[model samples]
Target: MLERLIESLEAAPMVQRGDYHYFIHPITDGVPLLDPALLRDVACAMVTVMDLHGVDKIVTAEAMGIHIGTALSLMTDIPLNILRKRSYSLPGEIAVHQSTGYSTGQLYLNGIEKGDRVVVIDDVISTGGTLKAVLAALENAGAEIVDVCVVIQRGEPELGRAYTPLVTIDVDADGVRVIDTCR
Candidate 1:
């Protein structure tokens, strides 16, 4: 399952930015174009490895994570909660500071409550900063994170927990190469 996704990504458009070679996948960068089939492939691969039983909600960040989260939510009939970059002054909304390899900002959490069992998903894990921040917020909210999944693992950051990543990639001046597979 992951081999198919990696093949598709390797064929996708790539642009070099300094020391990093970015693969412009539709699910992450919204570039090169949107491929529903590819997205479904990714979601299917993720669902195969995830333990979805008893999970109360599926949480993810805005933009890229939305697509994967929505797919998983539909697959398991679980509710999906997106952590938005913009904060809403609604009751019970909580915000946390997040610093990714690319940018830093505040991600607002909504619809999560105490004792909720959740599975967090993301597009990529480069620095693990975003996931770290989300984990902190979820801990503060008293929610139990059952599992963490990322489509791509770009860097080896100690997230203090285990996460299932479909494809582990390494990018450099040469290009992006699949270094390992999580499945």
Candidate 2:
């Protein structure tokens, strides 16, 4: 099942967590380019999670998640929106500021009208900080968040329906493990 795939991901060190090996790797390259096969696996996982979560549109951050989000969006036939960290020359775009646990950044949401349903996408969820900002931005734009999907979900679950991670990774002590299980 999903657990096997997650375990495999963990075993590969594809995603890392905290200062530990919640995942197999931390994506230190900031890009999954090192392993095309791994990237493909992550992309496939994203698509599957999105489909299961009933996601309509994919919303993600500007730099890191752009490639992964685009790939997943294309795979799922869903529209993609890039949440810019700062507003550029684009006019009429709704820009809002929020804090992720890691840092504070601005989110620019474009082309999405009020009341639209969107699913947030990212390459990884370390502390859920960036994802929190994305969620706030979506809410500010009056869009309902259908779910949050990532190639890997780090940290312990918040539970209680406050938020849901499409995937949970498990890694071994030696920075090697598989995606133990996915939720």
List lDDT for all candidates, in order: 0.87, 0.62
Clashes of each: 0, 17
Residue 25, model 1: lDDT of: 78
Worst 10 residues of 1 by lDDT: 11-20
lDDT tens per residue, model 1, 60-103: 99989998999888878999999998989889888989997778
Write down the lDDT that model 1 would get. 0.87
Give the per-residue lDDT digits (tens) of candidate 2, residues 33-126: 3454555666676655554355557888877788777667767778888888666756557776656444677777776668878887776665
Model 1 vs truth, CA RMSD: 1.3
| Candidate 2 residue 53 C-alpha distance from true site, Å | 8.7
CA error at residue 95 for candidate 2, angstroms: 3.0
